[model samples]
Target: MCLSFHSFRKLIASVLFLTFFFTGCKNSEKRTVKTEEITFIKEGELSIYKPGTDVPVLNLNIELAETDYETQTGLMYRTSMKENEAMLFIFDDVAMHSFYMKNTEFPLDILFIKEDMTIGSFQENAQPLDEGSLSSKVPVQYVLEVNAGIVAEKGLSIGDSISFQKL
Candidate 1:
């Protein structure tokens, strides 16, 4: 086929443009992914006390994860947690809550608490990045995620009550 010089140049330009566009979309592995730094803020102090006693079972500087987004992102990217640091997840009603360690970088002990703030159940030593469903087994209104072994270290039991104050 015979074509004018301008027409031939236009065809070449169009072909080059489409070639680069398709190739760019296919190279997903070369894409630059931007990851933001996750910040840890001590928003409150929570104390887990022995039931019916004034003695403290454990005290933690906590980050409150009450909203849907906050609760979903609870400690997922944290590399380390202070022995006295924790994340508290608050729900709107009392119900069974299941948690997994997806994207979590450190192990944790998840304490499921009843409506009255007493611990209902515990998921111990949840491994980092494990997608296993750690259910409360009973209805709960609150969840406390602390460093693994904190419960055993403090001798904390299911019936221990927790109280918190915002800072």
Candidate 2:
């Protein structure tokens, strides 16, 4: 069948419109994947332990993961985290490393930890996107994650120390 120029232009426009509509919806869907509310305690206090340390009490909600899988997965796929809840990623040895918000819907404050439980560096209010890497300025063995901006709100800063304890 032979088509007139006007009809062909109309068909092209329709195809472009549908393509944009579907693409927008797909992007929105991906954004919500990690936006669901997570069931974590907010009103309770938890302790953090600095392995092989003799310092005083180090009260923190996040705890170190003792297993390899837990350390590797860290906090991936978490939709939401409570204000008082956190995740501490531990490594067997101090090394250069980085983290990203891949698959993480909410923004976070990432604290790179040294072997002595001191914060090497921290990145606050990190954006969620694939292939975004937040790295430590120095070699570190532990990392802590909390709700975005909590670090500054709590008056925590570089050179301020952190320690952990067994619960």
Candidate 3:
């Protein structure tokens, strides 16, 4: 069918408007992004030892957080951690480091270890999802995160040492 110039312009404008309207509606639809629950993967085995003792006080299957990304994301999305599991963050330089419980679902015991493999300091029973800074008062080369109350239950103390083997 033949149409006047003004009629054709109106038809084109109407089509354009409807196209944009539908596209906008489609774009505005609510979208839920499914996030997979993170699970614990054992990368090593670590033992906490009493001072000057050959026997270990506690042994754990450890997940090492060595890379920058791994260290930064340490145990953030996990729902729960088993009693025998832990995350050990290894840093290249021995320095005072601080941690927070951001995005973590469960409470934790954070142990700071010095270059000599001795526990330098610790923060026990850190609440979940807390943004408060948990500090290692002394310079440390490693940080160990375990289920909350582990330190107290195991009687872990400053000067306690650790040894680990990668699996």
Candidate 4:
């Protein structure tokens, strides 16, 4: 077939554009990732005790958040936690600390613990995904997160104490 030079160049350009477009789309499809749910990892055990008591009021399988990244990402993106499971954040400094639900998917009760292992303050029934600051309102070295309503259910109080051991 006889064709003009300009027409031949236009045909080549169109062919190249379509080829690139389809190839790009196919590559993107292959790159699509299926997100899986994050599961809990047991790292320790914690016990909460009543004031001046030797026996524990509650015991929990805990996931420790000791690193900067672990503390910052605490419970985020998890759908839910078991009633017996909790996340304990260990900070190096004893100072006023605060938390928020942010990307957390379930309600929680946050306990603020002093260096002496006593509960200093707590925020109960923190709403899921709320970005509002849930402050300790006191200096604390540890923060414990558990399923909402656990504090009241366990009869936990400010003077209650905690002891933990890593697995």
Candidate 2 per-residue lDDT, tens place, 1-167, comes to 98899999999999999999999999988885445644543333344434444542335576455488766656677777777678877788899879888777788898888897787899999876555788988999988888898777766666656655445
Q: Number of clashes in every candidate structure?
A: 0, 5, 0, 0
The model with the greater TM-score, 2 or 4, is 4
Superposed on all Cα atoms, model 1 deviates from the true structure by an RMSD in Å of: 4.6
Candidates in order have lDDT scores of 0.91, 0.73, 0.96, 0.95
Off by over 4 Å in 3: 1-32
Which residue pairs in candidate 3 collide? none
Clashing pairs in 1: none
Q: Write the per-residue lDDT of candidate 3 for residues 34-58, one digit (tens) a residue.
A: 7998988999999999988999999
**Candidate 1 global TM-score:** 0.78
Clashes in predicted model 1: 0
Which whole-number lDDT from 0 to 100 does residue 64 have in model 3? 95
Weakest ten-residue segment in model 4 by summed lDDT: 31-40
Per-residue C-alpha lDDT of model 4 across residues 53-128, encoded as one tens digit per residue? 8999999999999999999999999999999999999999999999999999999999999999999999999999
